[model samples]
Target chain A: MVLSQKLHEAFKGTVERITSHRTVSAFKEKGVLSVTEFIIAGDNLVSKCPTWSWESGEPSKRKPYLPAEKQFLITRNVPCLRRAASVEEEYEAAGGEVLLDNEDNDGWLATHGKPRETKEDEEDNLPSMDSLEIGKKNSIQSIPSYFGGEEDEDIPDMAEYEEPDNLIETDPATLQSTYLVAHEPDDDNILRTRTYDVSITYDKYYQTPRVWLTGYDESRMLLRPELVLEDVSQDHARKTVTIEDHPHLPGKHASVHPCRHGAVMKKIIDVLMSRGVEPEVDKYLFLFLKFVASVIPTIEYDYTMDFDLGSSSR
Target chain B: MADASEKKPILQFAPFQSVVDEGFWHRLSSLKLNKLGIDDSPVPISGFYAPCSHAQVSNHLTLLSESLPTEASEQAACTSSVSLGNRNKCSVPGTIYNTNTLEGYHALDKQSLLKAEAKKIWDDIHSGKALEDSAALSRFLIISFADLKKWNFYYWFAFPALVLEPAATLVGIKPASQWLSPEEAEYLSAACREWRNSNLTADVPFFLVSIASDSSATIRHLKDWEACKGNGHKLLFGFYDPCHLPHNPGWPLRNYLTLIFIKWNIRRIHFLCYRENRGFADMGLSLVGEALISVPEVWKDLNSVPNAVGWEYNMGKKGSKCVNLAKAMDPTKLAIAAA
Candidate 1:
């Protein structure tokens, strides 16, 4: 009868139907597959979905409702809204979660943190790392005033998430120094191709003081800085892409990496819980699997330090 | 009458000092370029440099930065400062014209065969020649940023994908596509941990994304992507990868991905590539709800568009040579059964 139990059962069914690999239930004995969800008012975000994106979390939670760049559906039906990049933190500072601005005959299309209106201001459409899109149209200038933005009318359920505000805190130099700009132009001069390169390296000695040594904690340290870049030199840009290490997603020295001991495993475990999986089982599975997989190795790890968090034995 | 001021010539930093060369500054400062200028250039950041001597403008001074990528360190080697030269007019390399497909995508450094080296390293790794100490191994690689760039060494680091299929499956997620292979599934599951730790979102598609008209639609599509990308099983995200998607069940997975933006007074396309935004645009947001064609495809069909830079789909019609990139179509929408 409990919602968590229902979610557990539903996730089990979905996994059983779709996956051929081992299930959380099968690995339950190792204690690594626990489920947690965020219940916002009424909707329950069932997160046991094994996807690696921000969308993998329980949507119902009010705090980290998968920011706009990670909304589940671009439609009105699943209204897990987000703020426009520019005004996101401002809204957060105001303690707002859902942007209940969009309106339609369905009363409210969806609350995506922007006052639904005409897309008149060109300033609102500028592309920053944090900015989001109005549609898949990909042309900034071509985007019309909220004139036909109500085009989501075909879907009766889609609460049209009104456009959001653009966050304003930016460094003119940091923007250019990031090396994110275009060199070519279209016939008409609209941005047809853009390339971006951003690198932030860290120190070799990366160790965290928090979560120092909880006997049961499965934490480690990171010892290297990184270089990361993401470029969107699409086919239209007719340019060459130089973002080879596109997904490393490395940050400057000020970031946290667990092995180097940043946040306590328990804290990360808490975030994981909000995503749906129960931490107890997740850790148990990690330790158990580590134990099971270590059978034939020349030397087994001292059961004391669990380095690979993926191992059930950790 | 202000010729005295002109004679003394109090120099002001160029508005887009980061982008403009000495000639550009000279042109702008002398009222040659600013006469045709708009207030659209970028502003300067802190710790900016100005001409120490007007005569030294063209000559670059090699000043080292005390700022390291990490906390300020005593190690001066890590502290970098590039003395940039004036823009050299190297006719965009011929490779620009030759690169027509994904296989031939241009790399910043293309001297060596990266794939071959990656394969050899992988063989050594599999055969236990890889140093077991993971941290030391990683540390060794970190210092060689230029080498990695030169060798196209992503293959060296990405061997984890081949070895760990599940994580690899999540490597290049296509938005709203079918289930991933077990290897890919596990690979992606593993990647999710890194992705989650890094706080990655799908809609924040920097590497490759279709430009949008408004922030609302861009955010909407981004939320759609961010949600799916965090799923350990997601890979190769597709926010209407303007190059691929012919239709749904495979294309832009936002099940309800729709045309939310309308056309405005936007008369021409602008590739606003300064720090603010960078991407493609149609002359007038005119190409809204039409056939899903890739840029390469458009490029191949020179007559496809009446514009100078011929835009075409990556995958062309039957009997067409592979002049553009390669893309797979979803049979569900594009498949034609022989009657």
Candidate 2:
């Protein structure tokens, strides 16, 4: 609908009121046009202008980019607490093989028996004992008796009897081949597609941006709220989380509370303020969405990707 | 200049505008002061701190006293007496007048008092009581000032109100009181004209979709419209009664809608509602059209007629009559008029 002059004036008035003087000045000092000015000048004009420079320096020059380590601490899988008895039982159940170093190391086996010429030849010569029964026996024998004696020598050679060569070789060529096989364009791998369709709509009730994440499960089915919960960080999921019916979609969806969005935006504004720049209110949302996109890379949000700081326009 | 009684001299400094070059002050003095029959004296280049209006000062004091803790209030009261004495010494309403000397006239004391009061009020509001009392919450919103040169000041003002407050209540309070200056308004209008020109010549086609209520039938109708028109061109949707949606919070609808339009780079809008719903039309028009003018042009070209389409639905007949809002807006045709 075409805006009446009066209504137009009111909106303009609100924009003017909300525009930050500090953000604008900061933009000017950096020799870049304000977001509002960039918008008003049209994309063509803005594209022609010099790009905005960050006060800390160019992103590339700010700090050296460290490649992510291939093997880092997997905190999610680490158990915070464990019972001593149960842990001891688990260790014993593995036939004292649990404490063995990297599978490549042969020290643990050296104490048990001499290395065989080949795994197949060793397996052919070993007796086939009932694994479960042996495990049960090992657990019982693992506990030290109160009336101590030479129990260590009496313990059965469970490790030598069990299957040898259980550890797979980790040569670089084999590792690379395994990686290639996992990522190969197979039907099973194709079926396990990971995609998150993100749409940003306003919650009239909250007056804040409502981000909707419609993710596809491994089987390509629409994910339920409970399943989606698994994708969110545990700390975030624990906070005032709710599963509301989607306004436009078919079923119940998880709506993340945008409690942190404003603070994050404020931090960006603070950065701009420190640099003596005043950004327009309209520009805050745009910059904010981009900042958040880095946190949740799988979800494809609108406008966040289109913004080009280098070109000074979308 | 004659007839000194007709014109009152403006001795108060405008710190926000004070940073303007000497030429600007000279031109302002020549054009404005000369006509008022007052001395065309140049505004001082320096020594002026931030200026606070009387309403702001009084509001700050009231907020400080009511919201501050008892100990803080007691401390403030002790300080208030000293500030009060200083204020009384210079009783002039807008300008600070000094009895000691002619050049000593300055509002520095009052300005400092206002700043201290503002700080205390900010601390108290953020201390947790603002969430309980609607008045305190609204006061927090009022603190988001446009005239402040320091961007950090506005950032601090907006942060708590925007983040901490419940979304249900935050939408009800309007956040800002300042209006666009004449220069800003003119620039915005010119930008709108440029945007319109650029869009008119672009290769892309634009569609204006109208939404009235949030019913299954309404959704079906929108789907049909999209199916019919969303083939080659981009479809831009606008609502007439967005508040009618079951979950709508009512406030922030305009800004949010405008944001969506800009984000999607929508070209035109159709504000659809019953014949009497002027409120919905006004909101739709303000957000979809006026708000976009200040920003970049989203419309490809201006060849399309009636950039703003207003639809009035007839409840009894289950049909809507569309009008070209580019021609004229008739409030009598709004849905509210039928009632």
Candidate 3:
């Protein structure tokens, strides 16, 4: 298994090098970014999405090629209310419609299968209908229902799991009779879901914008690396997500392996172009976030915005 | 009142889990090497947390690049008072005692250090300074030894929580959505959203919430409690709760509870555990809990500091967490690994 994994890494590395070689200076064609282009795109993202801001990382660790402040783009405390597995289950249960069949060898968009029933409801409620992108409506609709349905049941069970210190002093009889049976029908309970501080840094190796996630548990404790994996979509969990040292930030963070990011971005851009939307290099992060959403669907980071994609078809 | 028939659970708080960023240690290493070669003094550092933003996850007091002093020459200034518009980063004032040697770190009087830290919080609570900035109630301490040669950092964080004598009892606890009427929840959510979005109040970790008979809610600073009490319809002590557990609130509430009981002479209080989802006030994730407290006789003197118990647990023990970042941070290893 280890040998196969090593082979896979080697193959991925070779593929990335070859693809990067082909699209040396091309952002639209190759879907990879130069360090300069990354800074421009980061600036554009920050201006568009106020939540995303440029951060100057450790002074000594700063890449000489990148500007001091533009070492990374960070948006902290992004909530992930549900596991991606739950989204997959719900989508399957709803008889999810495949928006686009995977034509490109990089079939990342195949995971874009979403239930269409909630689209009209979202379209009615959202005032900025023009800003609504094609695939965003479905996943956005899942958030509220996910909160309402799952949150109620999770609380009473959690109530039973209090600090042992609180329980020890109490009489054994009272503990048995009062607390264990006192599972009052807690319908109105807080959804204690995982939170993530998501960041993006330019990867010189793959020539792609790499995404990193630092997740915290309900009690603000750092989630174990394995626990962090539960939030990642099953498709990319083991294959694409790896715990590595964050380029700018301190400590190891779960990063979406950037080896196939360029290929995936290329496929996404082509799909957009076919739909009469001209993708801009500056708007790359937006597209990057949209695709990253498939890998980490439940992390409710602000990625969708009212950027004009120059869609003549619309 | 340990009446077996009517025994209710005593209110307990979940201890804080510290997350020291890689940059924090890296910066500390630089400081140790360049600025203070052998000086072992308590350095004031800033720790950042937001209102619990996720349903299950509590917001950790995260040490970032901005947590440490930037300049080697200048004394580290407390940046907790300066409100950065980012609602996600509410700075809490903290002190870090970095020792020269591992033996020195172990030799340091931990009990007295914790007492000293807790006394600062106690002083702030009594002097009405904590009312101005309740972030003072969440004062934290760190004792660390940076092994610069090995790039190993042995550190432990203590978020000093003043123990309430005759500990607070949980009258009732439930989700804010269930506790408040739809209209009341709506008004409270709107008020909280406004508070979180504002540049000034966004970083204020603690505040007072007054709900009118008409279900109109207003969020005020802790200092405005006197003003709020006069016009109060229904008052709830609101704080940026960092715990999402259904049973208990986070560690910050322990000191806040002490402050409310001792300072305000409040025996009973309805607290709003202000949590958020997607940057908006999430009433479902937020909690409303009623706690009853009796002021300890010792607190009447106002001179004696209460015994605190908030040394952060590492792997379920009262121990320091060590991080070896040599492979990740060393330039030679990085270059070799990259190749």
iRMS per model, in Å, is: 26.6, 38.5, 12.3
Could you tell me the TM-score of chain A in candidate 3? 0.63
Query: How well does candidate 3 match the true structure in TM-score terms?
Result: 0.69
DockQ, Cα level, model 2: 0.00
lDDT of 2 by residue, A34-142 (tens): 3333233223212221111011111111211111110000000011111122233444445433333334377666544334324434433332223234323332322
Between candidates 1 and 3, the one scoring higher on lDDT is: 3
Quality class of the docking in candidate 3, CAPRI style: incorrect
- In candidate 3, which residue ranges exceed 4 Å CA deviation? A1-54, A59-71, A76-197, A202-208, A213-247, A250-286, A295-314, B1-7, B73-83, B330-332
- Window of ten residues with lowest summed lDDT in model 1 chain B: B86-95
As a whole number from 0 to 100, the lDDT of residue B112 in candidate 1 is 27
Which of the numbered candidates is closest to the native, going by highest lDDT?
A: 3
Instruction: Flag the better candidate by TM-score, 2 or 3.
Output: 3
Q: Which ten residues in a row have the lowest lDDT in candidate 3 chain A?
A: A172-181
For A65-182, candidate 3 gives per-residue lDDT tens digits of 6776578888876766666765665565344333323322444643333333356346334422222221233233222111112223321121232233421222111112222112
Best to worst by lDDT, what's the order? 3, 2, 1
Model 1 spans > 4 angstroms off:
A1-264, A267-314, B1-339
Tell me the DockQ of each model, to 2 decimals.
Answer: 0.01, 0.00, 0.09
For model 3 chain B, the run of ten residues with the poorest summed lDDT: B74-83
Q: What is the C-alpha lDDT of each candidate?
A: 0.20, 0.26, 0.71
Candidate 1 lDDT by residue in tens digits, A68-179: 2232210000101111222333444333322332233344454322343332122334432233342123332122211112322211111132112221112111112111
| lDDT at B138, model 1 | 10
